[model samples]
Target: MINRYGPYKRYKQVFGVTSHSNPDKEHTVVITDKGEWQCSCPAWIFHTPRKPCKHIQEAMKDQVVQAFTPKPITPKVEKVLNRFAAIEV
Candidate 1:
């Protein structure tokens, strides 16, 4: 499987996609931020509603979906929590 996020691997914001068959008469694919996606091969050249092709499928399999999702928090709320903890009756 080829990595979509190749040259940009060192960085943390981009990904790339490699053709499943080096762009032939039957298949076409493009790596994009939206995810490894497919181009409509020769059809793309003709101009059609391009969709994710098979090459993207292969690359996706090798993709490392990061799970370090962060949730938003407010500073005011944190301050209130700290004050409440300090209250000793």
Candidate 2:
């Protein structure tokens, strides 16, 4: 039986998510600096925003792969502030 979420133990084995049956394999689920997301799942193929789909969910559960949450932009904001510098009257 396909568990509602699939086998967590097996899902963690997933290296990443990708189209189950694509020829060129151009479409893929990339686990990168960004996060765990898939652009090519039935749920995402049409309606969903940029969020993950069942396939991604399965992959994550099975693979034990945790998504990296990027730290808030405070540092980037600081850098931008430094770059602009305050204008003197």
- What is the Cα-based TM-score of model 1? 0.31
RMSD of each: 19.1, 14.9
Model 1 Cα shift for residue 35 (angstroms): 5.1
Model 1, C-alpha of 87: deviation from truth (Å): 64
Please write out the lDDT profile of model 2 over residues 1-77, one tens digit for every residue: 01122112212221323344753332322243334443334455565345676665665574453444322333433
What is the C-alpha lDDT profile of model 1 across 1-89, one tens digit per residue? 33232222222222233454554222323333444343333433333455444544554564556543322323432333234223312
* TM-score list, all predictions: 0.31, 0.35
Candidate 1 residue pairs in clash (backbone atoms < 3 Å):
4-16, 5-16, 38-52, 38-53
Q: After the best TM-score superposition of candidate 2, give how far the Cα of residue 18 lies from its true spot, in angstroms.
A: 8.8
